[model samples]
Target: MTSGLVSPKRPRNLAERLVGEFTREIRQARLRPGDRLPTEAQVVRRFGVSRTVVREALSQLQAAGLVETRHGIGTFVTMNRRDSGLRADAAEIATVVDLLAMLEMRIGVESEAAAIAARRRTDEHLERMRAALDEFERLLGAGETTEPADFRFHSTIAAATGNRYFASFMGSLGTKAIPRAHLKLPDLPSLHHRDYLASVNREHEDIFNAIAREDADGARAAMRTHIGNGRERLKLRQESSDNLEPRRKK
Candidate 1:
């Protein structure tokens, strides 16, 4: 059953978009737990994406434990037999905890990614990272959201790792990888917001500089610190809010 799963939009992030559509079907029970998914050919025709894109999308699904592909048969949903929703849930990133968990996962994957990027980055990779960093700064100055620029900056580092899978995995996480987009900590005082963004930009600079200088240990440390600080920032914000409430009540 097609279920109108097709999209006419030009291919931008085809695999991740397809993953979203498939997830909607599964969550809504349009495609139930054990039902077999459409064939690769059918998916290609419906989505107007290449076979390779379809395969990649399916591979992500398989990796998420949402579906299983047989040697010659077809891909089947694997949701109910196991806690298959974890991957889809992650991709959705619906809650604060989910976003925090995504950050933790990035800390594990991207700390090493930064180290490799530092060792492997070429002039071109450095240039791309610089461009992303510049754009982030420009957007931040304009009082605009920096989520896309932030994502590109991190993804550029992943690309510098000389591993397409690293980039692909980051791509699979999509824009949700930007914690600010998913988080709504009570607004810092205006000056505090400025300081916070400045600090964040400084962290970005540290990572970029380490990569440009080909300092693997520095890159890894910078990346770990950046993500770890973000986690703590949120945790502390939550704790402070909780502490303030009883005083306000009093």
Candidate 2:
């Protein structure tokens, strides 16, 4: 009979270590969409790991939708350039088409989220929403940026919908959405006309009112109308831009 014995040297656990490094780099956003990642051998050299460990780490990133490998080309940090959800851009030659696609996606998500929140919201959730709304108005009235409040408002709605996944996704993405939403809001101080903002404020109130009443149908309708109104306004703005199209116009 042979006695069992432990190995003197411990395994490096290279896969775990490589994954940690990769996760850190990706999270720091040093590796953005379309960014190329190092090759398998290159990754191994960087991590001081064997080839298998590098492959495992890369595979994990791929599974997480954080990266992709081309058949003959190198791996990329981000696979889906359309991850932003809104499709509009003028930087590229084909940006206008993409922007339209993006807006369509935003319309679908915002409308549905609103509808669902109506059916599911609780008093605590409404309180959270009101808090966010108050913060937004307070800051905006004070001639300061209200980005924090803006994020919280959307975040609260997503949470109120009783879907943890939706809430998490919104929290992750709301920072990007708010800046764009702020741009879409018509100028008040600059134009000296607050009607546009007032209108939006009313829409928000109508949404809250429906949710507070537990009027699921009303909430859905309110949210759908609100999202549709935004889309229509954006479309009209686009048409207005066409009327004054300078050569450099986005």
Candidate 3:
């Protein structure tokens, strides 16, 4: 009999059954470190599936960091290597998918940072925040890109929070594209009839007001509300686009 890795009577999709077989073999130590898996063809034969299905199964194992495939060779079990490639671009790609992943993170971090900065920002830090905010306003009004200024504003808040790590992570994100502008009440001719930006304005003002009043909790709450509002707007925009446009010419 084969390894009998799984009960032949298992109830699941073929891909799932393959995962189970691979996992069982791994757990039973039948598949050891550096063990090269049989070729995709062998898997096709064993699993009674096409090459495509075998590839999908191996892909799942690869995602789990349990196996790796060499271009010219075959798939092999990973002894100890961590899964670095699976989510390497998740943070970046999430922007396109969710439109709010970054803002959600900001709400969690910057909102609390706003609270801390309200209580702890030094004179210099306050000056920097003011400067950054001013630049943000200028760029936004000048019809120029405000992405950099927006980052500066958040970075200043992180600095004022008096936590170096906070600032560090915020800066780390700076290297990634910020989705704030995309989520902005876009300059859609359709949406321009009403004051869609009013909510956005209020949210920013609330955050600024909290900072001005040196109210910690208010700043945090305001920031969260602002981010949450943006997320909602993004959803609305996506929903509106669902059937609004005619099919594009191929």
* TM-score leader: 1
Candidate number with the higher lDDT (2 or 3)? 3
Model 2 scores a TM of 0.52
Question: TM-scores of the models, in the given order?
Answer: 0.62, 0.52, 0.53
TM-score of 1: 0.62
Off by over 4 Å in 2: 1-100, 179-193, 242-250
Better of 1 and 2 by lDDT: 1
Q: Per-residue CA lDDT of candidate 3, range 112-216, in tens?
A: 888998898777666655665676566556665445545555666776776655654653344232444333332476346224444455466677667877999
Candidate 1's C-alpha runs over 4 A off are 1-89, 242-250
Evaluate model 3: give its TM-score. 0.53
Q: Per-residue CA lDDT of candidate 1, range 1-250, in tens?
A: 0011112232225666797799778878898877999998999999998765675566555544567666578889875534422122333454555566778888988999999999989897787678767877887788876666677678778767866567666655655566565445666797788678878889999999999999999999999999999888866765555322110111
Report how far off residue 23 is in candidate 2 (Å): 9.8
Q: Residue 185 in candidate 3 has what lDDT?
A: 33
Worst 10 residues of 3 by lDDT: 1-10
Least lDDT summed over 10 consecutive residues: which range in candidate 2? 1-10
Each prediction's RMSD to truth: 12.4, 18.9, 17.0
Better of 2 and 3 by TM-score: 3
